[model samples]
Target: MDDRRELPRKLAHEHLARGDATGWFEALYAEADGKEQVVPWADMQINPHFAAWLAAHPRPEAAKRALVIGCGLGDDAEALAAVGFQVVAFDVSPTAVAWCRDRFPASTVQYAVADLLKLPEDWIGRFELVLEIYTVQVLPVELRRQAFERMAQAVAADGTLLVIARGRDATDEPCNMPWPLLHDELKFIETCGLREVSFEDFLDQECPPVRRFRAEYRRPATITSAKS
Candidate 1:
């Protein structure tokens, strides 16, 4: 396998040297979309933890619905489906959606092209399980809070929201590209009323060790409205 460990940091270094990480994302995606290049979720290493987590949590077998945000190619969605969850995976790029559909023709998964930040109100609270793997951090820091709230609102009252994100130690340099999550960033979800049930950090040994957080949040079963 092509080593993924050094690539992200290398890209970040390039972006930092250029002093335009955000611009780099924009330019890269623009070229990718232009060339109709559909990036695959498998390319992101979504399996190792996600697959094991899904295996451990099984979704009760009766819970059928799932929503995956920013599903580039569909490997993770397919993994969920293989475990009996009917998944609706959505990405903003039409090229990515088309690529997923073509790649998984016989798979019991649906792929759609939609902006995650602007999901329709009708879709709110509709999923039994929501998978957000590294998507929130991709947004600029200014929009990160609002983006997380939107993601939390999409989960049903009793559903689970699975988050897998890259992180860095508080003392580490504030670099870009795969922007690491900060402590206050984690609090934004709590401010939106979602409760964190479990959290674990995965650390890998390499030249620049990889640090990531896997967390699960759930909406409360009961909430009193002002009118109630």
Candidate 2:
């Protein structure tokens, strides 16, 4: 583990001990006190796999609205904006959201503080592209399925939802912070009415070569309905 991850792990344990699953995020961000390095996953750049995915896909101007879940530091959201997306990126921590706004003072992206577990009603089926990276795995196992359901429900008709996360086998023990996801858990996205367009399970170019899963899904448009 990167020594930087230790603080969050400690914070999580403390919060979870108090039966607070989500509060740890705000605590972690607040503890960082504007220092990005204190947050383990703040890479400060668009994720390479995500960049490659964007490059491979069609850049249709018609599909413009995008949403990013748990967008710490806003790198992915900024990348989407650069590619012409009208983006909404959110984190559970207000401190993190403030950090993003301060880092990109002129950004058009709407960086808000919102909990994924309790999404707003207007957000359901509202986005043309949804990006979720490394957010769900940080949640407790009991909440993972619901988190996935919220993500799928946010996709507009015929829109895309791209998910990137640490991969794990069904038999593997998820005994750490950012608990990796099983293949079956990943398939829960499909259960929420999206069709899988592509799926990749590979070892990333990290220092120790971490395994990653990148999956693309799209909600089907039945042809009789409006974009609504």
Candidate 3:
């Protein structure tokens, strides 16, 4: 791994070890502002899977609402806004939200500081689309289930949840920083009253290809359908 990349990872591990479950996010963003090279996950581009999904599955209405979890640097949030969704993108770090707004002064994306585990009441069941990319994997395993529940709760009755995360086999031991999601863990998202619409496992195009899971789950229009 690149030494520069390891800086934020080390900071994350240090903070998480000290029982600060979310402080490392702020520290990482603050450090990245000073030295952009430290943000290993900052691709500076919208996720291609999201883009392709949006292209192939356009919403009937142009004014849908979208929620982007852990909206780092606002790239994906901005992309959603560009496609005409009223977007609310949030991160746990105040610094990250401020940086995102500053980066896009006239942007339509409403960037805010919000915790996934303790989401705002008004946000529950309000979004037509919820996008989560690599956020839960960075969290401690104990917090992942709550994070998933919050993500699911934000979706409207007919809304869709898009999740993209690093994938690992079920038997793989938990690793540092981003603890890759096991296949069963990914499937667990369905337990939150959503139906799995599509699921795919593929190798990312990067050298020494990274395994990834790209999935879509939808909250059915009715309780009966959702249960089925």
Candidate 4:
């Protein structure tokens, strides 16, 4: 396996052995220091799908609340802020969060260390847009439902939740590193009371293209939710 891929799984297996599913994130980020490739997902740029979405839509006239799950190096959050979204980007890894702060000394995006399973109560149903790019697929499969539920819950009424992930058929063989998400697993998002807006299963612009799912879901407007 490529070192880019092997290192994370190696660290993950070690942490998982000690009954820690999330700790390896800090271990990997800490070990990486400032080398982006050391942490494979740290491309140090806004995700292309995210960039494309922003291009298609008009920029926010005001500061719309946006959240980035497992923000890694914070490029996505910065991009959101650049487009006038009030962005809050978080990672379970404290080292990664700290690195984001250091990297953007003057950034307005709030970079916090947070766990998806137990998100900040103040964040629930608060964001007008939630970006969960490549976060869910990295976690152990068993944790999928809870993470999806929480991501869904983060969207305010009539707000959008955009999930970008590697996609695999239910029959695909189990893989490593960034494991691909099964289509059926995503249904849980709808169960969390968000309606599917649109879903695209396509290949990205990688050298060797990879299958990806970019799904959008929206919370319906109701009597409440969304505090100023």
lDDT of 2 by residue, 74-165 (tens): 99999999888899999999999999999999998989889899988889999999999999889988899999999999999989999999
lDDT of each model, Cα atoms only?
Answer: 0.73, 0.91, 0.87, 0.91
Ten-residue stretch with the least lDDT total in model 3? 219-228
Q: Candidates ranked by TM-score, best first?
A: 2, 4, 3, 1
Give one digit per residue, the lDDT tens place, for model 1 in 62-167.
8478899988677899988887888989887676677678778998888887877788687699887889887876656777877788888889888888888887
Lowest lDDT sum, 10 consecutive residues, model 4, at 1-10
lDDT of 4 by residue, 1-228 (tens): 267888899998898788898999999999998787798888889999989988988998877999999999999999999989999999999999999999999999999999999989999999999999998888889999999999998999989999999999988888886889987899889999999988899998887889999999999998766699
Question: Could you list the CA RMSD of all candidates, in the order they appear?
Answer: 4.8, 2.5, 3.1, 3.1
In candidate 4, residue 167 scores what lDDT? 99
Clashes per candidate, residues 3 or more apart or on different chains? 0, 0, 0, 0
The TM-score that candidate 4 achieves is 0.95
Q: lDDT, candidate 3, residue 20?
A: 86
Model 3 over residues 1-228: C-alpha lDDT tens digits? Answer: 457558768887799889988898898888777454677777778988777787888654758999999998889999999878999999998988998888789999999899999999999999999999999988888888899999999999999999999999977776766788887877778999999999889998788888899999999885564554
Q: Cα deviation in Å at residue 164, candidate 3?
A: 0.2
User: Of models 3 and 4, which has the larger lDDT?
Assistant: 4
lDDT of 3 at 2: 59
As for candidate 4, its clashing pairs are none
Question: Could you tell me the TM-score of candidate 2?
Answer: 0.95
Candidate 1: Cα lDDT at 37 = 28
